[model samples]
Target: MFKIVKKWREQGTIERARGTGLENKKTTNNEDATLIQHLRAHPFTTATAAAQITNFPASRRTAQRRIRQISDFRCRVAAIKPFLTQQNKENRMGYAMQYLIFDQNFWENVIFTDEKVFQSSRNGKIRDFVLDSMKHILNKTIAVVDFPLMCGPGLVVGVPDCVGELMVD
Candidate 1:
């Protein structure tokens, strides 16, 4: 209370003074439009790469800040997908076309199997900036493990403390 009173007495108002810094030149409307276009064209590019590709005059950190200003944009872990060659793509398209005429009852009896290979490494995941509308395009998979049957006093049928064992099992 005393500090507030003293400050009020010293200054006429409690308003903050203007900052003594130059206005940001990198985040202008024209530069923002260019950055947005570059991101849309290459969503997986890093901030530094985007800045370098666009020939941005600002630092990489500034480029990152500008990216954050855009709405519905978020940095997320990249989905790992198998590399599909041209022949693989054509085969997948042909398979899809063959199944296009299947009715709901024909698809209802379909059984899909999920198989994932676990890797022991520290640098397996990759990060990327993505638009909100593009999230559904990414593939997401989770592995669920059920513990071996236990009939003892305490039957713990869940994941164990060891991550490596959980993945291996």
Candidate 2:
């Protein structure tokens, strides 16, 4: 039964297989933090179970090494306590109160406002930074940022030197 479980661990059916050290292998794109988080919450029954969590082919020895790596980081346990503390849940209203303390009229006089946004149709600010979305969307999407160049005289009203601003949160 042990050997059979070990074989399953090696095959990747079980990601957290103990003794394989496969999970220790540095991933280029790290697994979601939730994976590590799950392990902390539940100790697995078999090496096969450990192997299953890793999503990598792992043998008993590989699983052991990976478990060691995970264990080594357990020192971070102290930090998690504070991070998850109810104190963290305390009201963040100090900032909100301070904001209220300020005169609203002063802000109205300044004429600046902040906002958040998503993909745009006639409205603005998109940077694919991944691709030049401008040519594709053109006036239709408003992606490549400063396009429709809000600067030229043809534009009307309180717009700035740059194109329409896209507020993001």
Candidate 3:
């Protein structure tokens, strides 16, 4: 408070000087446009490669910063997904259509079950052990327990049993 008052009394204004830093010249409007064009043509190109083609050559770091300034684009790994063929799509559509015609009673006779397995390091008497030890054998186990069946209103009998399991390492 005292410092602020003192500054106001002497300068009559409370404003701090902006920090000093070298101005960016390598990424002018023209150079930035060219860099963007290069990136669009070859998205996987490295920053150093893109910088080399600009009118005013810049470092990889400078090229990256300029690209960030232009847009919110960022490099990332592509997500993996299963590829579905035309036959797969047609089969899925047919299955869905068959279910759509079924009434509430038909759905009540469907019991869906799923199981998941997990593996982790085990602890020993002396100290906790890691899986790196060759003697250790990771137990891959699955447990199945009865679960309450809840399907709409009244209790339905004779539901067909279906089981599915997913294992990950």
Q: Indicate which candidate wins on TM-score.
A: 1
Backbone atom clashes (below 3 Å) for every candidate: 0, 29, 0
- Model 1 segments beyond 4 Å from truth? 1-8, 13-15, 18-26, 79-125, 136-169
TM-score of each: 0.44, 0.22, 0.35
* lDDT over C-alpha atoms for residue 90 of model 1: 65
Q: How are the candidates ranked when ordered by lDDT, highest leading?
A: 1, 3, 2
Angstrom error at residue 94, model 3: 19
Q: Give the clash count for model 3.
A: 0
Query: Model 1, poorest ten-residue lDDT window?
Result: 146-155
What are the lDDT figures for the candidates, one per model? Answer: 0.57, 0.36, 0.49
lDDT measured at residue 128 in model 2 versus the true structure, 0 to 100: 20
Tell me the tens digit of each residue's lDDT in model 3 across 1-169: 9988998999998776345355447556888878877655544445565577655467778777877777444543323335657786566556545555778887676544522222221211111111222232223122222222343212122332321211111
Cα error, candidate 3, residue 51 (Å)? 1.1
What lDDT is reached at residue 64 by model 3? 77
Pairs with steric clashes in candidate 3? none
lDDT of 1 by residue, 1-169 (tens): 7766777899966655566345446456777678778766555556677788778778988888788876466767756666657786566556546655879886554433233354433445444567766763332222322112223111112222333322311
Count of backbone collisions in candidate 1: 0
